[model samples]
Target: MRIVLWSTAIVVLVVLVGVVYEQVGRYRAARDFPAPGKMVDIGGRKIQLDCRGSGSPTVVFEAGLSVDGSLSWSAVQSKVAAHTRACSYSRAGLMWSDASDAPYSARQVAQDLHEALTRAGEHGPFVLVGQSLGGLYATSFTKYFGAEVAGLVLVDPSHPDQVARVAAFMTETRSLRSRIAVWLAWSGLLRAAAPSLLPQAPNQTARDSQAVHAFAPKSMVTQLVESDATDASLAEAGAFRNLGNRPLVVLTSMAPYTEAELRGMKITPEQGKQVQAIWEKLHEDMATWSSRSTHRLLPNAGHDIQFDDPAAVIDAVMSVVETVRADRDNGSH
Candidate 1:
C-alpha cells in the first residue's frame, strides 16, 4: 500500500511539473513574439485588431476553427489592404486576446467583434470575409446587424445542418481521437509535441507556428465550447432569412484528400465523394440566402481556400468591394 501511494504521488508530481513547464514556455512565446496588431479594450477584455489601407467599405477577415485568428489572414489581408481598408482580429481567448467568461456562441462572438471594431474606430457598411467557423459568426453578424454589412465572402463555410446530416456517417474512432487530442492538450503533451502539432511553412509562418503552439490548448477548448452551442446558434441564424439585396459570394473547396489522408481518416473513395457532394449542396443552399449571391467552386483548393488560393479570396473580396462601390455611386444618382 505504501509503495502504491508513493508511485501515485510521483506520477502526480511529474504531471504538475510538465504542466508548469508548458505554461512557462507559452508565456515566453507570447513575450518574445509580440502582437503586430493593437490591443483594443472592448470592455474588460482586449482584442488584437490589425487594420490597413483606407476606403469606404472596410473589409474584415475572420478566421476559421484554428487559434491563429488574424495571422490566418496575414497574406490575404496584405493584398486586400493594397486596394482598400482590410482588417483582421483575434477573437477572445485567441493569441494576444484576453480570455472571455461569456459563452462562445456565434451571436455573442459577432457582438464582441462589432464592439471591437467600433472601439477601434473601424466603421461599416463592412465587407465580411469569413472562413470555416468564422463564416457562421459572420452570418450571425449579418442577421443581428444587417445594416452594417455591405457584402459577404464565405470561404468554405460550415453549414448549420452539417452535424445532423453527417452524424450517422461519423465514427466513434474520430470522436475518440478528438478526445485524446484535447486530453493531450490539457496535459501539456501537445505542447511538448508542438512541432508535430504545428507544421510550419505553407501551413503557417514561424511566428504564427509559435503562437498556435502556445495557445492551442485555449483555442481547442474555445472551439469545443462554441461547438456545444452550434445547434442553438444555427436555430437563431435560421430565423434571419432573406438577406435582402446584399451581395454574397460563396467559395466552396472541392479538393479531395490525398491517399495518406484518406488512409488516416479511414474514408473510402466513394464515401469521400459522397461527403464532397453533400458539402457542395450545402454551399449551393448558402448561396440562395441572398438574392444577389454567387457560388464558385475551387476544385484544387482545400477547406482553407484562403490559404490555398489567396488570390481567389482576394478576387472575391475585390469583386464585392467594386459592387458595393458601384451600388453606392448609383444610389447617389
Candidate 2:
C-alpha cells in the first residue's frame, strides 16, 4: 500500500511538471509570433506604439482583449493612414511591454492610454478605432475624456449588460462572487504556470486565431501576444458599459457565435443570435439610444465581425474618419 501511494505521488509530480512544461513552451514558442514596435513610456510602463501616415484627425487603433494588435489594424491601418495619421499601440503587460505593474482597472487603462498618447506626442481630436475589449477602452474615452474624442468604433465589444445578464445564472450575487473567485484562482494558476511567456501576447494571438481572425492579418498576431495590453483592457470592461456618447460607430456581427464566445459564459448562440437580431433593428431604434451613430451589419461575419469581414470594419473606420474630417473642417470654419 505504501508503494502504491509513493507511485501515485510520483505520477502527480510528473503530471504537474508536464503542465508547467507545456505552458512554458507556449511562452517561448509564442516568440515565433509578431513583435511590438517602439516603446512609449507611459507612467511606469513602456507602451508599444506604431504610428504612420499623415492627414487630419489622426486615426488610432485600440485592440481588444488578446487582440492581433498592429495586425488587427493591418487590414485597414495603412489605407486610413494614406489619408490621415494612423496609430496602433499595445497597452502595458501585453506583449512588447513590461509586466512590472500591478493589475489595472478601466480608468487606469484609459489614463495609461492617455499618457502613452501624450508621451508619444499623439494629440487629441482623435478618431478611436477599437475592437472587442479595445471597444471598452474607446467607449471609456467617451466617458472619461469625451471632448477630446472625434469619433469612436466598437467592434463587437463586451457589453456590461452581459455581466448583469449572466447574473441570472447563479443563485445570487454571492454565487457570482464565488464564480469570480474560482475564475481568478484558475487564471492565477495559469499565469503562475507560464512565467516565460511575454506579458500578454499568447492570449491575444489565440483570440485572433480563434474568434477575431476574420480580418486580422497574420502579422499583427505577433504584437498581440508580446504586448501586455490585454490585461489592462479587460480590467476596464466595467467603465465602458457606463460610457455615454461622443460619436460612436458600433460594428456588430450578423453571424451569431454566442455558443463560441459564451462557451464559458451562460449565454448561448441562439441568445446571441437574438441580440444580433435586435442590433439589426437599429434602423428602427436609431432615434433613441444611438442618435449620431451609424450601425452597419456585416454579412459574412462572426463574433469577431471586424475580422470575419474587413470591408465592414473599413466602412465603419472610413465613416468615422469622414466625421472626424467634417468635424475638423467645421472647427476651422
Candidate 3:
C-alpha cells in the first residue's frame, strides 16, 4: 500500500515538472522566434502572412499537413519572390498563428486565408502553389473564389480518393500516430526528439523549423484536428473538378517509399507498388482538370518535392506565372 502511494506521488511530481518545462520552453520560443511576417488580424484572430517582392498576380504558397507552416516553402519562396510577389502563411494554430475553436476543414482554411489576405491588403487574381494536403485547400479556394485565382501549381498533391484507395492495402496509422504526437508535444517530451525526428536541412530555415517543432505544442493539436477532418476536406475538394482553361501544373514525385518506410507501415513491397500506381494515376487524372495543364514527374524526388528539388517547384511556378502574364497582356491588347 505504501509503495503504491509513493509511486502515484512520483508520477504526479514528474507530470508537474513536465508541464512547467513545456510552458517555459513555449515562452522562450515565443521570445526567440517571433512571427517573421505580418500578423494580419482577421476579426478576433491573427494569421501570419509573409510576403516578399512585388508584382501583379502574387504567388501564394500553401504547405502540406504536419509541416513547419510557411517555413515549409522556405526553399522555393525566395527564389520565386525574385520574379514576382511570393507569399506564404501559417494556417490557424500553427507556428506563430492564433488557434481556432472552429472545426478544421479545407473550406474553413480557405476562408481564413481569403479573409487574411483581404485584411492584409493583399489583392488577388493570385497564383496558388499547394504542396501535399495544401493542394486540397488550394482546390477548395478555387471553388469558393474562382475569380481570384490565376493559376495553380500542385506539388505531389493529395487526391480526394487517396485515403479510400490506399486503405485497401495499408491500414491507416497516421491518425493514431498524430494523436500520440499531440500528447507527446503537450507533455514536452517531443522537444527532446524533435531534432532527430524532423528533416535535417543545413540552412537557417531548417533551424527555424526545428525551433517550431520543439516548442509549438498547439501546432501538433492543429495537425491532429486537420487529420480528423480529412474526410470532410476531401469531400470539399472533390466537388471542384474543372479549372476551365486556367494554367495548371501537376508535379508528381515518382520516388518509391523507402524500405524502412514500407516496413513501418507494415506494407509489403508488392502492396507499396500498388499504392504507388494509384498515386500516379490520381495525379495524372488531376492534370486533365485543365485544358492548359502540364503533368511532370520527378523520378528521384520524394513526396516533399519542394525540399527534394526546389528547382522543379520554382520552374513550375514561373511557367504558370509567365502564362498568366501573357494572357493578361493579350487580353489588354
lDDT for each of the candidates? 0.82, 0.59, 0.86
Models 1 onward score TM values of 0.91, 0.67, 0.95
- Clash count for candidate 3 is 0
Ranked by TM-score, top first:
3, 1, 2
Off by over 4 Å in 1: 172-177, 180-186, 201-203, 259-266
Best by lDDT: 3
Q: Judged by lDDT against the true structure, how good is candidate 3?
A: 0.86
Instruction: Put down candidate 2 lDDT per residue, 55-155, tens digits, no spaces.
Output: 76777888766534455666667677777888887665554554434545566667777878888888877888877667767767666876777777778
The best candidate in terms of TM-score: 3
Question: Which candidate would rank higher by lDDT, 2 or 3?
Answer: 3
State, as a TM-score between 0 and 1, how close model 1 is to the true structure: 0.91
CA RMSD of each candidate after superposition:
2.4, 7.4, 1.9
Q: Residue 132 CA error for candidate 3 (Å)?
A: 0.9
Worst 10 residues of 3 by lDDT: 197-206
Clashing pairs in 1: none
